[model samples]
Target: MEVNRFESINEGTILLIDKPYGWTSFDVVGKLRSLIKKYTGDKSTKIGHAGTLDPLATGLLVICTGKATKRVVDLTADSKEYIAKIKLGETTPSFDLETKIDATYPFDHVNRELVETVLKTFTGSQMQEPPAFSAKYVNGKRAYEYARKGVDPKLEPVPIEIQSIELVGFDLPSLVIKILCSKGTYIRALARDIGKALNTGAHLVELRRTRSGVFSIEQALSIAEVEKKLSNMCNQS
Candidate 1:
């Protein structure tokens, strides 16, 4: 059945966007809002994203528009899947490449067997502390804001579930793994913990969200693609 763009958008629509690197989740929302306004001529259309992806990470970002905004909670609550590349022998305040290396350790003892064993320990429910440089609010300010000013915020460990972790590639100093975790799980923190388990330090180098609930990267559209689609819809209108 052919759907009318205005009617569909006004009612509700879930947009699966492939968020580009270096762009905050809010950037995607703002860009889409502009395109939507241009297309529908409605400036007050509701739009929001289900989850926030760090500027360093990229992949499927579930964006809900119009009445679909109500589904943001449900969408964010779903299991998330990610492929991460963690660099061992180094630690960073941000737990990822977003920050400079603060410390380093000998990773010579790390091997495939050790990696597998350490990953096993992270399976199931556990309390994990978020990175100091995270969006987590602290004292009415974002944690990252404190981190930027050379201040450490006291962040409590939150309970999270790790459904599974599979070693995709294992090379000395670099471990590529695929993870399926519950909402609120931080891959950067996981990387830091994994390094600790091995008696070494580690930090996330590359991370991508391959899936969120039923939405996969395969179903996501780039910002440009979305813009074009909206433009076409506007022309049709």
Candidate 2:
């Protein structure tokens, strides 16, 4: 590929990158900004991304460069799909594997059939309360900040819709499930709520965003691959 052709790549173009584990959305944007500057040597082109994925989770991260930053508002509202593993018999303060396990219960009472039946309850529109260890604002401060301390704040319930929930697999206390939901849906909350419904406790053990609207993992470029592409451009010049 010729370096000059990128000049025609234009602004407002969308790029999908498979975000690596343990990297924040801001981290991705920073690396991308550096890569873009290294290749184009043009600092005026803007770069941005739609939506935020927790560092523990990995998958399609939609990136917009140049004029595409203007469309982030609309893109952030697009539906997202994820394949996640929920670990039963344990409850975490953050509602995911990232937090400390506050309690654990016997899971002999939960089976595949029971898990399937519980899925029925999560489907459809419902009001869900965000986790205490979340980015959601609380009294003008981030909820996670208050949660990290000893204070448990009053987190309000927000509307969310589960378009579909499928039981992919189950291995005793661990369950693999796929979810398609509207914006603002929290899988962490779902895991906790499902645990509550089953007389057990649950937390997200693993998570991967398989799809985000038209963007899919299939269309995503790895950070290394993207860096390579930029490098090739510099060498050619």
Candidate 3:
């Protein structure tokens, strides 16, 4: 059989990777594609990510190779969990640190009680406007294309469900939250909405996907680890 079967990749294999900050999802996929081709000499190997992770965020990213690429849809449909750090009293155009702060607000009136109350309202089904600087496609082009050019394009809201949100840390001006949400939910947008509901502007500073479907960060491999595995595969092949 041409299949190496290492990691049971004969037909397909799902790799849970702890994606590092600054590495885009495509970057990981590209790196793996090159590695697999180098190790197994299978130039036809197909690879793809279940979902796209922003370049700034870090966490468990589901990567599929070979025939597993066919399961991208179902893998992406899985619920996800994230640990997000949000900055109150500020707003960014990108909703995260990807862009400069566009505005600021007084968070002095915002308190813990208000935070908890507002977060409760966010749980359940609601319509969410994705950040203009997101990967959303508009008229066959990316929404960020308009956003980066200061062109305001009409982006419609999408239905998203937030199963639960927990306030992990609550020091003024900075909030840490753990969120369990359905697919397509953007935590950066959640930070934006939370800031609005709290009567203060807010933006995301950091985000990490702790869990996705049945996969957890605890079971994920780092880039170095992935490289090691590929090296072993190369030697075995």
Best model number under lDDT: 1
User: CA lDDT, every prediction?
Assistant: 0.90, 0.86, 0.88
> lDDT per residue, candidate 1, 1-237, as tens digits?
112233477568888889999999999999988888888788998989998899999998998888888989998999999999999999988999888999989999888998998899999999999998999999999999998999989899999999999999988889999999999999999999999999999999999999999888888889888888888877887
Model 1, C-alpha of 165: deviation from truth (Å): 0.6
lDDT of 2 by residue, 1-237 (tens): 111124432354777889999999889989988878778786777878888898889998988877777878888898999999999999999999778899998889898898899899898999999999889998899999999996897899999999999999889788999999998988899999999999998999899999988778887888998888778877887
Q: For model 1, state the Cα shift of residue 26 in Å.
A: 0.4
- The lDDT, on a scale of 0 to 1, for candidate 1 is 0.90
Worst 10 residues of 2 by lDDT: 1-10
**Model 1 spans with C-alpha error above 4 angstroms:** 1-7
- Tens digits of lDDT, candidate 3, 1-237: 122235655358888889999999999988878877777777887788887789999999998877878988998999999999999999999999999998999999988888998899999999999999988899988999999999876789999999999999999899999999999998889999999999889999999999988888888888888878888877776
Model 2 segments more than 4 A misplaced = 1-10
Q: Which ten residues in a row have the lowest lDDT in candidate 1?
A: 1-10
How does residue 77 of candidate 1 score in lDDT? 99
lDDT ranking from best candidate downward = 1, 3, 2
Measured over all alpha carbons after superposition, the RMSD of each candidate to the real structure, in angstroms, is 2.1, 2.8, 2.7
In model 1, how many backbone clashes occur? 0
For each candidate, give its TM-score against the true structure: 0.95, 0.94, 0.95
Report the alpha-carbon TM-score of model 3 versus the true structure: 0.95
